[model samples]
Target chain A: MGILDTSPRVRAAALVAPPFLYALALLAFPLIAIIVISFWTQSGLALNRVFTLENYREIFSSPIYVWGNANRWGVLPLSLFVSATVTLVTVVLAYPIAYFVSFVVAPERKALWLFLITIPFWTSYLIRVFLWKVILGFNGVVNTGLQSLGVIEEPLSVLLYNLNSVIITLSHAYAVFAILPIYVALEKIDRSLLEASQDLGESRFSTFLRVTLPLSVPGIVGAVLIVFIPTIGDYVTPELMLGSGGRLMSNVIQTQFLQLNNWPLGAALSIITMLAVGIVSLVFILLNRRWLRGRA
Target chain B: MTYSPSAAPLIQLRDVHKHYGDYHALRGIDLEIKKGEFFSLLGPSGCGKTTLLRTIAGFEAPSSGSLTIDGRDMAGVAANHRPTNMVFQSYAIFPHLSVAENVGFGLRRDPRSKAEKARAVAESLEMVGLGGYGARAAHALSGGQRQRVALARALILKPKVLLLDEPLSALDKKMRETMQVELIKLQRNVGITFILVTHDQEEALIMSDRIAVMFEGNIAQMADPETMYRRPNSRRVAEFIGKMNLLPATAAMERNRIVVDVAGLGRGAIEPDQAPSGVQPGATTVGIRPETLSILFPGETTDRRLAAGTVDEVVYFGDMTYYDVRIPGVEQPLTISMKNLIGRPVLDVGAVTQVVWDERSLVVLSR
Candidate 1:
């Protein structure tokens, strides 16, 4: 008998087995290991392997400082704030570019416009982040250019080595993530809906607000989660740009595992960060569902 | 309702032209549509029928000439500012909105109270026979339901003109027929002028009081359904609107009457009105609809002109039977339609028969 004559259950198993097994091995296994380790106790140069609430107790009770900021409360909220700001900035900036590519570019030239938008990705992301470092440095591109143009009397020290520099770098680094999803959403919109809005007596701007924006909610949500989740745990931008001043949760987790030799503590921190990201993403998905009410 | 000659034209276009870069979409269109008239723009695709409708809706400005509605020139007005609404071909219902929200979309800028606008929305939905479907999601509705929602949304605005861009083309045959009757009834009840763009000639004939037949960016003919079907101005239009058997003929003007010698049906005198575009003495064509010609049974008799022919092909369509009758003189077989009744028979191919025709049914077209 041919493959088409097989039972639906057998066909479904054949179709789904590969990816399901791959995800189980690569994703679920590591997460399960981390969750188990989060509950174990860490001794000097050894792991007790005994279940204990000591790590959780210390995590909730202690107010230890990391680079002059509290590790538990201060650094976590700072990471969230920085990631939220970057997400807002990246999405807000990416929306107009996506809209231009989808609506303004001619049908034949749209591929060229999207290619140009993604040109930054041709280079390594780390290299792009280092380039932002060069651009935002005190004696770098922005300050020097402004001084040469007589717009500034001196180099501005406030341009780099702060939370702003980390935000600027991460926003630039994750720009393509925000832009691609938003562009796909905008492109999927039926152009007739815009004309219908105008026919219903709405201005072009109002039509964009009422029809185009709401229809692209899925893309916006996709972009938000894509940028927000990864940037919240980003260690590179904070370490490279902010120096020791504004280190994030990722830097602390790395310190525990590599420098402090606390595998159990690092695994616990990783679990907590994962849960935090999950909750925030869940909140965002819920908001997206609310925005997409009554839609197919 | 049909247009009245005495009333002032509600919308007038004086030599309107639209050019999209190198393509000439509309070429010097001059039109007048009266208020409360159910008018249609009918053509095959790329015939500039939709372009003319878009021009009236203020979506595309004419490259030249002036368009006016209610005596005001529509020069700089945008689509949103124009007193016109459209039901898009795809229905274009806002997928994110409920039925009520979509119907009330145009009322965003209205000065009325919120309750009054809500009531207007409800009433508009009721008019389109979607009264209790307000809370339903627009994207969840079927094709016919979405069409009704689109109609309700546009009609809620109560604009001077309602533009429909092939609104019924997406529905199934039965649903399209149902909507056609509903649209006619709605237009009558609302008293708003509806300008429908359609490629389906039958739908235009059934729905429109007057139809403008377009071909290659030009208006070929504009008349009521009966006049359009009976006295099409050109051979192309006659072929486009319905099935017309164009027989080769020669015509000569004798005083006021035109004499045409059809290849198969012989010579006959025709009135001036039989040749809508005016007949010149030369080789021409004469068109006659299939139903206008009949086949005589053995026991039947008629006062009409008769010719001896053999049935070449037969197609039975339940209630009617079409036969291709080949006469001795005509090169192409002429199709004749006959209704199947209690006593009539479906003729078989190769059967010898007498085809009945009339001189009054001849429409002469210049070659």
Candidate 2:
């Protein structure tokens, strides 16, 4: 009894209890409320609050629902596809930079290179995105440079107001999120392992393919999760820069609450989108664990 | 203790020198390692022993001179193309691979079937006494087992030479002693040139057939174990090898022989060969190992030179006892070890003692 009373476990629990309670009230309560509200119904401004499955039925059966849209063809799937593509491109682009930072830079200069990598983050994310908006917009940097060079007869309007521009902007905004984890994974590898591979008759390229690439999967998976999860539901980036044809699942969900005045439908759309993301994430983790844990 | 003269030299280094920016790592090293010889580069850390091993392994190229392995010049050859393999001091076992994969890592480019490669891995593992440990993760093994895995992996390729960098230093004393004997037997069984780099003097003495003792990027002395122990050429080499009590002496060459008078120990007439490096006029020293001088037992009759001393310090080991005796004229007390046999009394401090001296074992060194 004396040892138990003197132990730090009780004090640790007391210290952690505050943040745990805060998350419960702030995060968990709203999630549960969303699920509960998806099962309730609303009618015309003033209505009787009655529990029903109509909101889910409407989401599944109506043509105006996310999946039934003919041209956009389910903003849910489109958003998931866009986020996944951005994650892939960003990781492919940032891999070399992370590798260079971890291995190529001298030990004393590594801190300086990492600081340079993170310098873009000192500015606000919104401001960085807005700057990219200016660079990619019609009559922006690319069109102006091309026109002055006489390579283009007119300002290119196709560069902005498209899914390509939105993907580019999102990738730029989330570059730090992708680079840091990958850099950490690359840095965690021991130097002797690389030498051992070369000593065992592997070429530099094959050694990287077999050893360095396989061990960096955990970081790649981390970057994918970080970029994809938030980007799937990103409303502001699309609202500011996306063309009329580039509505994601979040835009329709926002419309349900603000214009449609149907909170139940909005909650239903959110629950559906969350389930899709969770399933995709779980599949990724299961595959990552199987491939990396078994081999690496 | 025997090196076969018929065995041809496998590695020849000629005036090899390596420099890193301002630091000279290896300075004009020239040596020849015979086929099937267990050679050692032994020194304290930063003596360029490891750099020399790396040069032989083709991981480092000498700055100016040339190195030839098995009669082929090794200039600009990568480690993968070289005929030598190294077991790193850290073992460098790939954690992500299995024991079998690690053992067969060098066989990836071999034009053999997978089954044949697997058999080779198994055979190498069994050779190192790690039989049937192929499927286990490399990171899961114990320290001794990891060392064995490293040995098996390096030896599996059957290179012309195998290099070990402080292989036994990571083990505890008992494990280290066991591995030392096992390593000697392994080298003999494999019958390749084994060059070990170690900072431990006793490990070098126990394991090497011939050792090149390095100091400050230069090989100070290269000799067989018995010669290194009995006849070190210089005072520095003698002190580095083991405990030696150096007595300031004056030597006079008379009739092709050197007559030396030690400060505390009496004079002796020694042959010319006893002074490996010819003794000169100025400050000369005669070295005697601790075991060469013994405290004669009471009532024992021996027709040998004797000295009188008082035991100044007593250190008792379970099997032997060391007595530090202060003779009248010696600057420092001479340490003598005696076996703790039955009925042989262990002397205490301040006890009067008789020391039996062997004049033939004395070495004249130039400091």
Off by over 4 Å in 2: A1-10, A46-48, A62-71, A294-296, B1-3
Candidate 2 residue B301 C-alpha distance from true site, Å: 2.8
lDDT of 1 by residue, B1-367 (tens): 5456566789999999999999999998999999999999999999999999999999899999999999999999999988899999999998889999999999998999999998999998898888899898888999999999999999888899999999999999999999999999889888899999999999999999899999989999999999999999999999998889999999987786789999878889998889999888989999999999999998998998888999999999999998999999888899888899889988889999998988899999773
Which candidate number would show the highest lDDT if scored against the true structure? 1
lDDT (Cα, tens digit) per residue for candidate 2, span A1-296: 64447659887887789999999999999999999889887778853368888888988887655565655566777888889988988888889999999999999998898899889989987887788778887778888989999999988887788788888988888888999999999999887777777777777888898788977889999989998899889887877778676677888899888988989989999999999999999999999987766365
Sliding window of 10 residues with minimal summed lDDT for model 2 chain B: B1-10
Off by over 4 Å in 1: A1-25, A65-73
| Candidate 2 chain A weakest lDDT stretch, 10 residues | A64-73
Weakest ten-residue segment in model 1 chain B by summed lDDT: B1-10
DockQ scores for all the models shown?
Answer: 0.83, 0.57
- Candidate RMSDs in Å, in order, are 2.5, 2.4
